[model samples]
Target chain A: MTDWDGRRWHDMGGQAAGPVPMESHDFALWEKRVDALMVLCGQKGLFTVDGLRRALEDMGEEAFETYSYYERWIAAVNQNLIEAGVYATEELAARMAEIAARGPTYGEAQDG
Target chain B: MPHDHPDHDHDHHDHDHDHDHGPFHHEGMSPSGHPYRHDNDSPLTYWQRMEIAVRELLIDKGRITAAEIANQIEAMDARSPTNGAAVVARAWTDPAFKARLLHDASAASREMGFDIGPLNLIAVENTADTHNLIVCTLCSCYPRNLLGLPPDWYKTRAYRTRAVREPRAVLREFGLDLPANTTVRVHDSTADMRYLVLPARPAGTDTLTERELAALVTRDSMIGTGLPLRP
Candidate 1:
């Protein structure tokens, strides 16, 4: 498991401490690797569409409907993976659970 | 069921008709119906009404001043280009700096004197054979520090809906068509994390200075819907 530092985590308004430096090539490689992991997690049902929707709601984002929510969730998950490092996978999973808990209680009308 | 009231003599002979003249027409109206007629006079959607109510409450409660919000908008309008141009110029001229930008965009932006905040998160991605597009599917969470205020079209629900679902078609509407095989990655920003696209440097103009290179980077290019300026 990645080292969990509660103190390092800040709310959205807090300042970012910057990303861990790596060469562009290395970073790209890592991104691909992480993307593969997310795809696997998604396929295995560890990250459901509902799960992603809930997560966005937890973050105070209300514009995401079902389909859009899933797509945006994947992007957010990938971002979290990159920023938190692979060791924080468990933490990411937990965050997803938190989101799912707050997922839309009622169906939303599809916007054209 | 037919009943005749009166009968009149009909003449078959007719004068020359003026066919060129047509009935007067307005821009949005059709001859058959009034385009502007509506059953209700409501001017706001549920979400729009909610947004207005919330903003009004915030003002009334003194949680946030209207002037402060306006100042933020003014600041965004002022500082957006600096961030976008700086990123593009650095990426074109310095490979090391580009690498840093790809790894962490907010930090790179800060180095250029732009503070990226008020977002829950920020992520930057790059592509060579592929192109990346940015949209806030949920709300307009933009990299205001880099690109200034997002264009009005970006805030429309149509753009938010179509950009993610059919990105290639959307880009085509914007007059940007990538090769059929070119990969298209759409990044959907939310209230949390904002995003900015790092467009590939265009060919030619190797002799141009950083400022000149920056000039070539347009706001649309950073959004991934348009290419860098040619000259």
Candidate 2:
């Protein structure tokens, strides 16, 4: 599906759509962390921004509708990192489980 | 479909957190006058968990450092519409710089000591006869290094689609009514190149200093959604 030559779901140019929503919000700490990782990994030559975009596109339209911007971004960043052999999915899953057990809130879960 | 997150609550809350983690302080607005997002107080989300895991894995592998990550975040925070405003103001005043900016935006921006960091930037000039609008039809490919992060609207599917389809109507919604004779050129930001709209200088601004002129340049003007503030 990533190879679809027709207008992909992510490709919204010239398509009929509704009014532009103008509300904006400041990035949360965790969201900023996700953004930093994306930039740092790209700077480190581990992956290109295009690779990140490709991963986001491959995640399909459902993600664009359901997830928040940074959520999708972290997913794409993780996907690219895994594809780049930076870490195994098993390692990621284990770490996630460990984090989840730490606390119910983000403050308690993150390392000091 | 457009995914919309509720605007972050501006009311300050007292959470049960004993101590702050990392560089984020949960008090007051950031230096930029924007309120900090309530991170520690929010419930741990699945995506946040993924972010923590990925960041930790990258750190464990010695691929990136915590300090480096902090520094990068700080750098991005430092970038805002002010940078683009300064550039627009400079172009408004200096003909030579404007020519250089219109010729090569990245170089001109770097010449001003703004490290745009490998972003292929293009400067589109708006004249009396023509106006320029920018949209990333494929994704939100904005000139972020210059203008900071794209606004919430810029990344929306409605904007992404209609900006190219009916830019005039879109601009009208933003309260900008272009004349019928003006040609609207919408720049679709692709994977490699980003665009900055060099909005036409407003009249009666000849006496204003570069800094003062910069104040007239709004972020939406640079994005071509709205005009520069009237002097």
lDDT of each: 0.51, 0.87
DockQ values per model: 0.02, 0.70
- The collision pairs in model 1 are A54-A99, B120-B192, B121-B192, B121-B193
- For model 1, residues B1-231, the per-residue Cα lDDT tens digits are 011101111222221221111221112322222232210122222322222232333345454444444444334334555568777888779888787787787787777777665443344444667888888765556776677656546644556667777778778878888899888988888655778888777789789999888989887888877888897
Score candidate 1 by TM-score against the native: 0.49
TM-score of 2: 0.94
In candidate 1, stretches whose alpha carbon ends up further than 4 angstroms from where it belongs are A1-112, B1-73, B120-126
Candidate with best TM-score: 2
Candidate 2 lDDT tens digits, A1-112: 5766687799879889888887677777787789889989988999999899999999999889989889999999998989889999999999999999998878888762
Candidate 1 chain B lDDT trough over 10 residues, lowest sum: B1-10
Docking quality level of the chain pair in candidate 1: incorrect
